[model samples]
Target: MPFYSSDSDDHRTPPVKMFGRQRPLHAVFGGGRVADVLLWRNKNLSAAILIGAALIWFLFEVVEYTFLTLLCHISITTMLVVFIWSNGAELFNWSHPKIPEIILSQSAFQEVATTFHVKLNQFLLILYDIACGKDLTLFLLAIASLWILSVIGTYFSSLNLLYFGFVGIAILPVLYERYENHVDYLASKGNRDMKKLYKKFDSKVLNKIPRGPVKEKKFK
Candidate 1:
């Protein structure tokens, strides 16, 4: 009788799988929108590639100019100093540098350094994106017009126009590619996290909600 009762209970109702096709809440809020924007912004591969190429060429051209060259050096130094100071202060008790060092060793410092590296790489990616295509073209045209006028200036007379142009032609593409790759990596990681979060919530709360066939929207 017990075995028969157990059999009847088993046939009473099949267990419902608590995983549904509910959209991720975060995805609905802004994750998908942000992803769309990121993709849209990066869609014109040709334009981005060309801009990167041009900037590289221009950078090479300007590398030899004493003022521009000095500016690059100064900019790099300033960025490094800012990164170290900001991150170091946050990571360690920079108010007492020696005390923090004694307590945490250089390992804490190294962690801060790593954070700076990540941030700097991200900044470079942004800069590379901005420096190309519309931005680079306008900038170059303006600089060229100025350089033509400056040709008569004795101090600016030593500029190597041909060499600078050649360098820009050579370098920008490679730098742009690096930035593109980094951006892609970041995007993928973000998407993956969003998917994971969506799945977690969907399996729990969302499954309990009645679901219907999802209608797709077509947007031009």
Candidate 2:
């Protein structure tokens, strides 16, 4: 009979995490202090906290009423507006007022126009390149995703997007860890299918297309 000792294999610690990457809830959204208790000890509690916080944030974003916003601290601008309105706008009105003409000057409009034109041209050029690129499949996929998001926009508040994304991140890691083998098997199957489809298309459809002439390199 052979006996194995505890000292046979030395224990190794987890990799060093930066910006509190070791933290539970903070690490999900951003890096912060390591919440050892919540992270390693009680992950379920951490998940609950994350879910509850996301829900609270969503409610805060959707309910932006003036007085209600103050207690929630939804938006400082909203609170200020409410304060001004409640105090009466006439309080700031002076007998002599000298509003600057340059505030609405055509020069400002010209600057804005120039900026818009430059940015619009850049956007168009990028779009054109994407359309002409080999990554057209991904470009079309992105467009489809945008269309789906537009449809989703009609039914849900934008805040729900952030809320759901945060919750998903918090819950997904644990789920993936528990079902890694299953995920890997499914992923491998999908990869094999895609490769086969690509090969078929290359052989049957792509082979029928005429090839473009290769350009000769110009010597400097």
Index of the highest-TM-score prediction: 2
Assess candidate 2 and give its TM-score to the true structure. Answer: 0.44
lDDT values of the candidates?
Answer: 0.50, 0.56
RMSD of each: 25.5, 15.0
Q: What TM-score would each prediction reach against the true structure?
A: 0.18, 0.44
> Cα lDDT of model 2 overall?
0.56
Sliding window of 10 residues with minimal summed lDDT for model 1: 13-22
Q: How far is candidate 2 from the true structure (C-alpha RMSD, Å)?
A: 15.0
lDDT of 1 by residue, 1-220 (tens): 0111233433453322112114432232234322232233344653465465565545655454455776788799977876787778867867522323346557656655665576588668755665565554334545677687676454433334544454454444334334644544444444445556667877897788988989999999
